[model samples]
Target chain A: MKSIRIVSDFNSNQLIRLWKNINNNIKFSNNDFNQVYQEFANYKNRNDITVFWTNAQRVIPSFNDLLEYKDFDENVCYDEVRNYAISLKTYHKEKSNISIVPSWHLPLDFKGIESQNWKFNYGPKFIISKMNMIMSEIFSQDENIYLIDSEIWFNDKIDLDINKLWYTVKVPYSNNIFLNSITTFNSILDGVLGKSKKIIILDLDNTLWGGIIGDDGIDGIKLGGHDYLGEAFLDFQKELKKLKRRGILLAICSKNNEKIAIDTIKNHSEMILKKDDFVTWRINWDDKATNIQSLMNEINLGLDSAVFLDDNPLERDLVKKALNEIEVPDLPLDPTNYSSFLRSLNYFESSTLTKEDFARSKMYKENIKRIESKKPNFSFDRWIKSTESKLKCIKINNSNIERAIQLFNKTNQMNLSTRRLNREEFLEWIKEKNRFVFLYSLKDRFGDLGIIGLVSLEINLKDAMIVDFILSCRAMGRNIENMILSHIRKFLIEKEKDSITAVYKKTSRNSPILDMLKKSDFEEITKYTFKRNNISIYFKSDPNIKFEEINDKN
Target chain B: MTIKQIVYKCLDEINLSLSDGDKLNKSKDELLIGDGGKLDSLALMIFLTDIEKNLKNHLNIDINVLDDKLMSNSNGPYKTIGTFIEYYEKKNEIN
Candidate 1:
C-alpha cells in the first residue's frame, strides 16, 4: 500500500478516517503546531511521504491573544509566522519526498452589529495573504516541497463547523467539510506522488453537446446559449479547453461519419471547441476502444495516461473493459452535472504552472502538420528533416522559467535524471554563478513549438555535472536532444570545461532515456553515473534545419 | 398525503439499495427507525430527509421530520411509520 505520514497543526485524525480505505496514513500529535519541523525531522529518513497540513489559525494570532497585548505591532505576528515557515523550509532544503499544505482558510471577520471596527476587520485577509506568501516561498525553495492551497478545498464560506466540533470532538471540522474536501485532499496526495493523468480522449455527440451532430447537423446541435441544456454542454466544453491549455492532450473518438463530424467541428457556431482545438481525432464508424487505442499510439502516450469520457454508458463500459488502465468516468444522467463530475475526477491536478502549459494547445496544433506531412510516404527521418526546424537556445531567464519548470515536470520519456524542480528551486539553481541552465525553443516551418527542452549544468573548475536534461515528447524525435547536447558542449568548451558527467535516474515510465547518457558519448563510470573525458566532440545541427542562439534580454 | 402513502413513499426512496423481498413486509405501522429499528441511524436520516425534500417539492410545504420535540419526547414520533405520519399531521394542523 502507499505510505503517508501527516503532521498537522489541528486535530486531523478525521483524515485517517477519510483515507482509511486508501493509503496507510499515520497522524502525528494534535495541537503541536510548533513541533511540525521536529516531527518532520524524525520521519525524514522513513519511506513514507511526509505531509505538513497547516491551518491559517495555527499561525495567525488569535483575537484573544491580540487583546491580551494592549500595544502590539501588527507586523510581529506576520513576520514571526513567515520566519517560522522559512526556517522549516531552510531545514528541509533540497530534501526528497516532503509536502507542505499552506493555510487556506481564516475565520471571517464578521462585520455584525457587535463591533464595526473596519481596521481590525482586515486581520483575516492579512493572515490569509501572509500564509499564502509563506507557502509560495517554501514551494520555490525546495523541489520536493509540494504546496496544496487550502482555499481550493472549499467554496464561498469556510467549510468547517469549528464551534460545534471544537467543543465536542476537538477536531474543529464537521463531517460535511471532510466529505467536500476529500477530493481536493486526495488530489494533493496525487500531486505529491506524481500520479496525475496526461491525456484526455473525449467523445463527441451527446458528450460535447446536447445532441448528435450527425443527426442534428452543424447549426442544429445545442451548445453555448441561454438554454440550460446548451449551457451545461458549453460549460463542460469550456472546462476541457482549460485543461487543454494546461498541457492535457485532447483527442476525439466517436462513431460518426468523419465528414459530418469534421464539418460540425469546423463550422458549428455554437461549439466552444473548434476542429483545430483537438490534437487528433478518429471520427469514424469504428468502435471507440479501437479508435482510442490508435489515438494513444499516435500520440506516444500510454493507456494509463489517457482518460476516456463518453456520455453513453454502453460505450463507457466497452472502453473500460477493453482498456482497463484508461480511466472512463461514469457521466451523470443530467448534463448540468457534467462539468462538476469531470472536475471532481481530478485527472489533471498539477501543483505548478509553466509557460509551456499555456502554450501546450498551440504546440499540439503544430503536430497536425507533422502528422500530415508523413501521410503519403511515411519516413520519420525525412519528415523530421523536411520540417526545416530551427532551434533557439537561450539561458533560462524570467521569460522562459515557466517553460523550463514545465519541462522538468512534464518531460518523462527523454529526461536523463527525471529530477523535478519547483519554481523557487529552479530560480536558485539558475541564479548560482557556477550553475547555468539553458531553455531551448524550437520553431519549424509549420509553427513555433514553445520552449521544448531544458538543460542545467553545475560547473566545478574544468569539470561539469549535468544537473538536469529533459526534452518534451512533442520535440523528441526531431534530433532536438542532440542539438541541445551540442549547444551544451559548445558552452562547456567556451568555459574551458574539460570533462562532463551525468546520472541517469530510471523511473517506471522513463525507460526511453535509460541508455541516453551512453548514447550521448558518455562512458559509464558507475551504476548510474557516466563521464566523458574529452569535451572536443564536434557537433552539428540537422542539415535541413537552421539553428539560432537567442540571447536572454530579460 | 395519507399515513399509508407517506410510509410507502419513504420506503420507496430507500428501496434503491434494498431488495424487493426485504422491503415486502414493510407496512404503515412498521418500526423502521430508532430503537429496534429496521434501518440504521444513517439510513433512517437519509430516508427522513429525502421524504421531507420530496414532500416539499410535491406539496409546497416544509416539515422537520427530526425536530427537537420528536427527539426529546419520552416516546418520540419516530417510533414507527404510523407515529411519524401522526406527528406530521398534527404539526401541519398547527401550521
Candidate 2:
C-alpha cells in the first residue's frame, strides 16, 4: 500500500477511480479551488509525493475573455500565469514533488483562424497555447514538472456530456479521457522512478533490412536509397541509431553464418549501422531464444530490460514462448509501417539523459574487444596484464557530476546498496562537508572507458559509513573495486579514523556484491555490517598492467 | 443481424460491468435515460457512442444520435429501445 497524495483544483475523482484500478493507494484532496495553492505550499517535508494538477480554465477563469476580444494582448494573462508557475516551480524545486501542467484545450478563436482576416503571426489564438509554451519552458529548465498535452486528450474526447459534467459535477473530464490521463500519468511516474527497459535485442535478417543477407548477398539486400521498402527499413534503423545515441544498448541476434553476417555488417555500404555499432551480436544457427539469454548474461542486463524485434512471426513467436519477460512487439506485414510502429511503442522512455549516454555504445564496443581477446591461448592473467588496465581515482566535481549520478542510478549488478538519487538530491548531498564522493574512470590498451565508478562516503570522527558504491559493468573484471577500496582506506588512515563500516543491502540484481565487503577483507561485525581496522592499504595489481592517476593537467 | 440484435449486442459491449439486476431486458417504452433511467450519465454517453461506432464500423452507416434535427423532432427516438430501433431503420432507409 504505497500512497500518493494529490492536490488538485478540479475534481479528479474519475481520474482517481481509474488509477485505483492500477494502484489503489491514491489520496485525493478536497476539490476546493482556493485550497489547492495552500495545500501545495503546505506539502513540505512529507513522506508521500504530492502532485499538483490544475486545469487551464481553473488557472485563468478569464480564459474566455481573450477569445471574446480578438485584439487582447495575451501578455497580461501570460505574465500572470508565468509568475504563478515560477513560484510553484521554486516551491518544489528541491522537493521530490510532481506537477502536471496541461495545455489549453478550449476552442478559442477557431472561427478567427478560419476567417480571411486571420494572421499566422498573431500570438497563438488559444490562451492554452501560451500556457503550453510557458509550461514547456518550466518543464525543460526544472527537474520535476511534466506537461500533459491537454489539447490532444480533448481531441480524444468522444462524448459531449462529459464536457457538461464540468458544470454539473466538478469532474474535469469523462471516464474515457480520465482513463487515458491515468495511463499517461503512470508512464511519467515510471520515468521519474527510474524504471525502464535498458537494451534492444534486434533480429538482423528481415528486421534490419529488406532481405536476408546470407542468401541475397550484401549488395543484393534492399537497403537505403529510393527503394520504398529499403528506405522504410533504413528509416527504422536510423530511428534505432538515435536511440543508441541516447544510451539504449543495441545488440543483434540472427540465425546466419557468423563470418558472412559479420562481413556484411562490417563492409555493407548501404548499412547505416556498421560492425562497431552493435554492443554484441550472436549471428549463428542457434535457437534465438537461447541466444537472447546468452546476450542477457553477456550484457548483465535483466530479461525485463530486453526488447526483441524480428519480422518473421515464427521467430517472434518462438522467442515470445521462450522468454515471456522480454517485450516482443508484433511487426506489421508491410515494411513501410515498421518505423511508425516502433515510434508508437514508446519502449525506450527515460526522463533524463546524462553525459555518459552519448558514449555508452563506444564503451560497450571496447568491452567487445576484451571479450574476443579471451581466447584459449590467452591466459586470464596474461590477458589482464597485456591489456594494460589503468584506474584513475579522482574527487567528484561539477564536470563529471552527470556520469557519477548515472553510475549511481543505473548500475545494479556491481552496486553495494543500490541507492538511487535524483539530480538535485545528488547535488545537495554532495555539498555536505562531512560527505566524501569519490569517482574514477578506467582505460586500457583496448580503449579509454569514461568515468565508470562512484563511491559516496559519510565520514564522522570515529568511523566512516560507505553510503554508496557502484561500478559500471564495462569496468568490471579488472580489480578496479580493490583500487577504490584501497584509496578509501588511505583516506581513512590519514583522517585518524577508528573503523570503516560497509553494509551490503541485497537487491534482486545485486547478488554479485552480496559478499563484496567480505572479499575486500572487511570482517563481518553483524548480519549486515562489515567492519575493518585502520590498517595499511592492501591491493594487488597485475604486473603487465600499469595503473596511473590522471591529474587535472591531463 | 436484426436491428434488435444489433442494439442488444451494442448495449452488452458498452455496459460489460452492469449488475445482474441492471441487465434487465430492453423492452419497448422502458425508461432507458433521464431521471428514472437504468443507466447513469456516463453509462448513457458510453451507450450512445458505442452504438454509433459499432454501426459505422460493422454496417458502414454513420448515424448521429445527438443530431439537433433528430432531437427536435416530434417523437424523440431516445425514448426507449424499440423507438430508437425504429428511428434507426427509417434513417437508414433515407440514407
Candidate 3:
C-alpha cells in the first residue's frame, strides 16, 4: 500500500474519508495541536506522526465550532492566532518535502442556519479567515508545501442571502461541501501561483493546420472537415477555442499572407475559429519573435502570460530564447497527440468561471470593430451604440446562486453593504417580514450576460435600507449600476415611501462605491456612508438606454 | 529591536526551514544560529540578519554566521545551530 501522512487541525469523519480515498496506510499523526505547538518551540525534538490524530490541543476539535471566534475582532484574533501558526512552522523546517493537505471546516457553500444555536455549521468562513492568517507565515524556503483550494464559503455566503428559508429551516440553497470546496480550493491554488495562463497565444499554418497558409492560398490549408490530418488541426483548434471561451486570451502570431489567413477564418465554413473571436491578431511576414513581442504589447500582457504554440521547434526555440518569459510547450512529433497534449495544458486552471469569463472573447472581438474605424473623425459613442448595452436584472435564482455567491465574496471595488452574511443571518433576513435580495445581469450590443450584480433591501414600511449592492469588475465603467438603482427608486416611489435610504459601509476594498456615490452627487451623510435616494435621480436621466422593472420570485 | 530579538527572528526563520515534527518539539537549546548550527551551509549563505529582516524590523543583530566552528563543540551547550542559539542567549537577557 502506498503510504501518505495527513496533517490537519481537526480529526473528522470527512477527513478519514479523504484519507481512505488517498491511502489506507496514510498514517495520520493526531496531536494535541496545542502541545505539538509547544514542542515546536524547541526546534530539536520531533513529534510522532501517528499521534497528531488525538492532540487535544488541536485548534478546533471538529467542524461545528467554526465561529467561536467570529464576534471577536477578526484582525486581532488573527494577530494572536498567527503565533500559533508560526509555532506550527517548526514541522515545515524539518520536513521541507512533506506534502500536507488541509481540511477546511465547512465547504464554502454552507451557511450555518439551522437555528439560533447552530454552532457547528458555520463551515468555511471561520476556517478560511483563520487559514488566511496562517498562510502568510510560510517562508520562501519550503519546497514540499501544498496548497488547498476551496470556494464553498463564497458560494454559500452569497447564495444564502438570496430568497430565504423555503421551509423555515434557514438551511441554504445547498450543502455540496466536498465537490464545491475541492473545486474552489483548486482555483485559489491556481490563483496564488496563478498557474493558469489567462491567455493562450497560437500560431497559424502548420501549427493550427497541416499546410502553410501562404502556399495553400487559404483554400489548400488542411483543416479537417471529415478526413485524417485536417481532423487533427480541427481538434487542436477546438481545444484552443474552449480555453478562449473560459476567458483565456487567444492571439495569433504568424508570418502569413494576412488576407489569406483572414479568408480562412472568415470564409472557411469548416473553420471553428472566426476572425471576430480573436482578442488580438498579428499576421505579418515579420520575424515570429517580433510579431509576438508586438502582440504582447498590443494585448497589454507580459510575454510570460503568452503561451506560444507553434509546430516548428526552431521557431518555438527562437521565441523562448529571445523572450525568456513565454511558455512554449513543445509540440508533439505527430498531430495525433495534439488533443491529448492540449488536455494536459494547465495554464488557466481557475477555480470557478464567473459570467465575465464567458463574455471576454466577444468583448475583445469588439476591438476589431474599433480598429477598423480608426479614423480621426470616428466617434467613440457611435461605436458603443453598435455594441448596444443591455442590462438584465434577475433576482438571485437557483441557476445563478453559485455565481452570485462568488461575486459577493470576490467583488471588492463597488461593493455597498459589505457585511458578509452567515447562513443563519441571511436566513433571519429572508424569513423576516421586511427584506428582499436580488442580483443584476448586464450585456450590450455584445452579448447576453446572465447575471452580474447584487442588491438587497430591508423595509420597515416607512423606511428602506440597502443591504448588499455590488457589481462584477468586468461590468465596471459602464452605467449598468445607475440603470439598476433607477429600478429600485421607481419601486420605492410606487410603494408611496417618502425616501429610499442606502447604506455604504466602509471596508478597505469598497472604495469604488464611494466614488460612484460622489460622481452621482448623492448625499454622503459621512465618510463611507450614504442617505436615502429621491426618485428624481433616475426619472430625470437621458433616454439613451431602456429601463425596465423586473419582479419575479427567485 | 535588540540583539536578542534579532537572534530570535533569525532562529525562527531557520526553525521554519525544518519539518513539522522537529518544529513541534523544538527546544530553545536546539535552535541553530550562524555558522554553528545543523542547517546546511546554504542557510548561512543567507545573512542571519536577512532572515531577521523578514520578521518586520523586529530584530537586529550583528554576528558572523559562516564561521567553520559554529557547532563543532561535542561537550559544550552550543553543539548544533539549535544549541548555539541557546548558549549565546544564556548570557543575554530579553524581556
Q: Pick the candidate with the highest DockQ.
A: 2
Worst 10 residues of 1 chain A by lDDT: A369-378
Each model's Cα RMSD:
26.0, 24.7, 29.7
What digit string (tens of lDDT, one per residue) describes model 2 on residues A284-316?
A: 644577778777777766788889988866567
Supply the TM-score for candidate 1: 0.52
Candidate 1: residue A301 lDDT (0-100)? 63
What C-alpha lDDT values do all the predictions have?
0.66, 0.68, 0.56
Estimate TM-scores for all models: 0.52, 0.58, 0.34
lDDT of 1 at A196: 77
Which candidate number would show the highest lDDT if scored against the true structure?
Answer: 2
Rank candidates by lDDT, best first.
2, 1, 3
Native contacts retained by candidate 2 = 0.00
- Which lDDT tens digits does candidate 3 get at residues A92-123? 55642333334233432344554532323232
User: Per-residue CA lDDT of candidate 3, range B1-94, in tens?
Assistant: 6544555555554344344343312455553443434554333333243432333333333343334464344545545445555554653444
Model 1 steric clash pairs = A140-A424
